[model samples]
Target: MFECFLEIGFEAELNTKEDPELMEIAYEQCKENVATRATAITELRKMIFARGECHPLRTDDEYLLRFLRAREFIVPRAHKLMVRYCTFREQNKHLYEGVDLWGLVKVKDAYEGTMLDRPDTGRLSVFRFGRWDPNEFPVEDLVRAGMAMTEIGLRQPKLQILAGTVIVDLEGISYRHVATLTPTVAYQIVCLMGVAIPGRIKGVHIINYSWILNTFFYLFKKFIPQEAWQYIHFHGSDLKSLHKHLDLEVLPERYGGTYRGVSSFGIWLNKIKKYRDEQFDREMKQLGYVIKE
Candidate 1:
């Protein structure tokens, strides 16, 4: 039944195929073209190999293009992102230990939703902090799960080209949830979403906001980059305000939209199982992700 929704708009966009329209978007927004793309990827590869670290790196055009697109085909910026990405993995090796979707099923608070049916936007991914049980699952595990999902999403050209948005629902957040975010973890999170990954996040909408959420933000505001912080919009239980940025039809009823369907991680897990091949495993391994049995 959930697959029906997947079939509607999400499934088709999950592939690597590049449509003419999306290609135009890429060219206009990211300056991507045959000549520029070749040059950028080559420059990025040269920079990456010059580091003499990040061994077993996948320097193929497809893999390198991700960073190039993320940085709008700017070789230097893309190279920096690749370095920071590798550095993040090296510093937080524990997060990748045995991190896979199957292992992350217990993390029930987050799920990827479909993009707006409109052709203008990419996708919207939602994370519900209020539904998270910190005691049942460690914050580290939650971060790991999030990283796994992001890696999977990045495989699609649609996501890379069109970019995406994130919704952080903070309705039921409590002090206990806030306490779990140590200063170190807060910094790591800021770096993870803000810089390390190639995800072209268009915006992040924070709805159902409460003072507890504000307290968390206040304590960690210094860690957040100014540009990224600017992208964050807080709507305190005001779905009307949230709808101004996003179409109401695309949002689920829980977010004050008319859509009555439920968003489930299980549906996403099933959909992404196709990515659990030998090649995907190798890619993860090369990126320093430990694939636990």
Candidate 2:
């Protein structure tokens, strides 16, 4: 288990001010407390070294806080999640092959269903899969694109604290698109969403549902865990129902909102591109990502 090692200097100074409302949510929902945060992070880091499995990881408080928040501050569960995250990365190295900020932004179509310009309650992120051209972009590229989005999302401290919501628009989905998701591929997607990623997904709103999607879910629900299933919702072309879960003001016109601007993938790509800086590049390298200049 200790084939390679990276020693992290664990520090006791883990105090960073957060909004009072968000702090309340973190304490009430995720068991996070400024008072005990340093202790929890220290314990989590110690467990990582003691287990000797999750080597070469980002042991900094900000990074470790993601897992702690995701697991509601349980050190053992956070440790398991960290191990699962590293294991998933190792086993599915192909999915992350070219997942870099600059490179990913160039793949314009990859951002089709994404809504990142502004966030809904708690930084809601959306992806519309119905518009994706499986013929032009392989499903593997879709996974890689999603990985890039997750990497960027992890960088936002507010997102980690408030958590996020996902909206999967299936407006024009076809059988051809559903066929691309093999059982193995579906399982991997589920693992990436439910297990690997160290962010809390409060709700997953599925709009524009079709029999095709219904049939697909019936077949693939086995791959989804029970807890994740609770988050799954079906809106079926009713924007009103979707609005109940997310803010109608934040949704684009296509989703029956008043916002009159293009929310295309390219726009989001450029937005996140401008978000990069020296610190962003260093953090990406720490996570073992290659940044294409």
Candidate 3:
């Protein structure tokens, strides 16, 4: 239904979904051309196989391109991120199970750090904060849930090539919230978000933020790479700025937008349903990962 609302007005500089011209721009900016893609794949495969393992998305042309574009098509950068993404999934089998299981979503639902529904025009995504129960779920669980959301986003053809945004709504974060964010954990999260995934982060908007939580900002600044940190925006409860940057065409009215009735979880469930249980199982098997849940 939101698709009915048009006249984007080049307001969104990165319109990967409808404009081949913009997509071409992304390819150029990322140095992602036909020749470079082929070369990267060849080099990436050789490196992956040398590690005595298989990359699940190795032969997936789209998957490789997404990574290449995310890393600006630099062979070394893309390969490093590619390997890290695949290997991390392989190593952390328990974090992600089959799509049928929906264990990650279940955990997120229980813990209250839920991923918001509907992506913006740029395919930017959002997740809720403040509702999270750290004692019950912890940062690792949040990361797992985030990964599952990323996987779901990546499966959608339009989103794979486009970058994403995350809006963290902080109602009243306290010292305990800051306590959970250490440099090491922050670094892992930064890597998972910035690289090691098909969905690259275009921006991270932290809204409804409390000044008291400033103590934890340093962890992100210190751990998250400088280049990546530039994308991080602290709205400090500025809804208008957040809405403008995200473009309300895609945001639900609840978040200061016009779009209405976007089911918080149903859209994601539909995407996951399209992915199917068996396909996820097969991918897990290829990665030599077991369904922990």
Winner by TM-score: 1
After superposition, candidate 1 runs with Cα above 4 Å error: 1-14, 17-21, 51-56, 115-120, 259-262, 274-276, 285-293
- Per residue, candidate 2 scores C-alpha lDDT tens digits across 161-240 of 76777777777778988888887777777775656778877777887777788666765689777778788888888888
**Candidate lDDT values, in order:** 0.72, 0.69, 0.58
For 219-284, candidate 1 gives per-residue lDDT tens digits of 568877777877888887888899898877767777777655444555665545544567666767
TM-score of each: 0.88, 0.83, 0.72
How do the candidates rank by lDDT, highest first? 1, 2, 3
lDDT of 1: 0.72
Tell me the tens digit of each residue's lDDT in model 3 across 1-293. Answer: 33332212111212223345455655644555654667777776566567644465455555566666777777567677777787777666656644333544544332221222223335544555456677776776676666655564555444555566666666756777778877766766666676567567778877776666577666766656667768878878677887667766666666787655343333443334443466555554454434443
Task: Output the lDDT of residue 183, model 2.
Answer: 79
- Per-residue error (Å), model 3, residue 249: 1.4
Best by lDDT: 1
Per-residue error at 99 for model 3, in Å?
Answer: 10
Candidate number with the higher TM-score (1 or 3): 1
Candidate 3 has an lDDT of 0.58
Can you tell me which runs of candidate 3 are displaced by over 4 Å? 1-31, 34-36, 47-62, 86-94, 97-101, 107-121, 261-277, 285-293
